[model samples]
Target: MPLYRSWQTSHAHIAIWEITETEDFFAASLGFGSDKKHPKRRLEHLSGRFLLQYLVPGFPFDKIQISPLGKPQLADQSLHFSISHSYPYAAVIVSRQQEVGIDIQVYQDKILRLQSKFLSAAEQLICANDMQRITLTWCAKEALFKYYGLGAVDFKEDMPMGSLQRTTPEDALIDMRLEKTRETCQLSGLIQEKFALSYI
Candidate 1:
């Protein structure tokens, strides 16, 4: 089990798993009831469950359901959780205290082409022509979208990437706004050697 890194608070815990095992490995151990046809997707789903269980011992995994808005929630909303994956990696965040969101993305230059779709002109200016910065900005907004826990979000308009400051060589502190809900969150992001992870 390649557990990459984890963060924890008094009521919340987030974990990431580097997927190196075969789908069969997770299938045997997880035995998830939903069988995804795509092999890669199946692996991601199983790994997410495994990580979720790891973060919160005895979480009611069987009670999980997707809301009409496409956010995963407990049948009774007893526990707040979120999940995300980028090929070969899966992430989960669980909170007994508050709703949560987490996202992990494998670093790729291709994101630049889609920046215009999710980022405004001002947002782009703040990124300042750096792919790493651009990638982290995108991840921050994605985390915010997940944090919002509802569908039909306009990335560029609904979630705006605010000012960014480099705290270290490979970490950044980001400010983001949820325009629709008029809420703000400060998120910390990590630029791993192969991927980027963000949460709030």
Candidate 2:
């Protein structure tokens, strides 16, 4: 599989790859061996390497650790990051001096099945126009969860996403805008009939 990588912002970098072939190459790119150990530990190791290569210098790959919730952290507490992956892609977002999280999902029918679990009643009412709205709602909520560093929180109860107005790519120069009772975040992406890609 080929890998596509780019810098989203000066302090933020994104690594996106289509994982159609195998996880071996992905693992190697993250500097992991095939040996089976602790999955969480291995993820931290990989996350560490990516951070050092792009953020720090002379840091040992194994020197980082992950929280029980699967968030990566430096054993020495120097950097912060989050990792996410979907069926065919994996992305890691890293920041040199701030907390960051990233999430990727392959838009699919499965999201519809869990709509009630994630979307707020207000969101549902606003998105009633089309089924695709449901997918975007889910993606937005998921991205919010990652941004807050709370994975899979009660999307309906914990982090309710308010109504969003879809802005043309040219109108706002951004993709989706998510609002909450207290804060707002921008999600950039495109939605097709089958799937969507969003970055927060």
Candidate 3:
């Protein structure tokens, strides 16, 4: 019931969950644990793993290994996944055939000031000072970074977002370029009143 929505892409399944349950619920249900010091952070950590198992039955939680770049991966690479959380919400993308990424971010006014660090001058202008657009842009690139799954990426230079193409009032498709791979990919995104979600 906590699963807010799930979208099945051609090659992967993306799921988002509204974290309405207590940490104990996840801890007990999944036999999962987190050592995060903060309670909310601890909850987010548990919920991420919970969503993974929810998306893929019998996910090998015990076999997850962290790469040198701190990306969690399966040694056999049997499944490629990315997990992200913004407090009360958590999301995951899983693909047995391809690396995947997903991100959910609660809108924050402060992102306006920090935009320069992650967004280039041109990318900022593309946002046109709109917080929803700004947040979606950040999420879009962040999704790309996770998709790359290698650290030391420049959000400003590595991924540039094109103008948003609004598919629906709440949903949009963003064309983003992956400088690292010299390829372009369209990130599917949704802009809500309080948050933005993106996946690649």
**Displacement of the residue 83 alpha carbon in candidate 2, Å:** 1.4
The best candidate in terms of TM-score: 3
Model 1 lDDT per residue over 41-71, tens place: 9889889988887877777877889888888
Residue by residue across 58-160, what tens digits does model 2's lDDT show? 5456766766776557876566666665545555666666656565566666666667776667767877735566766665666666666645566677655
Better model by TM-score, 1 or 2? 1
Distance (Å) between predicted and true CA of 174, model 1? 1.1
* By lDDT: ranked, best first: 3, 1, 2
Superior by TM-score: candidate 1 or candidate 3:
3
Predictions in order: lDDT? 0.83, 0.56, 0.89
Q: Rank the candidates by TM-score, best first.
A: 3, 1, 2
Alpha carbon lDDT of residue 102, candidate 1? 78
lDDT of 3 by residue, 1-200 (tens): 57888889899998888998998999997886799999999999999999899999899999999999989999999999999999899999999889888889999889998888988888888888889988998898888888998778888888887667789999999998888899899999988877999988
In model 3, residue pairs whose N, Cα or C atoms come closer than 3 Å (at least 3 residues apart or on different chains), thus clashing, are none
TM-score of each: 0.93, 0.68, 0.96
Candidate 1 displacement at residue 145 in angstroms = 1.1
Per-model C-alpha RMSD: 1.5, 4.9, 1.2
Candidate 1 displacement at residue 120 in angstroms: 1.1
The positional error of residue 25 in candidate 1, measured at the CA in angstroms, is: 1.5
Q: Which ten residues in a row have the lowest lDDT in candidate 3?
A: 157-166
Between candidates 2 and 3, name the one with more favorable TM-score: 3
Candidate with top lDDT is 3
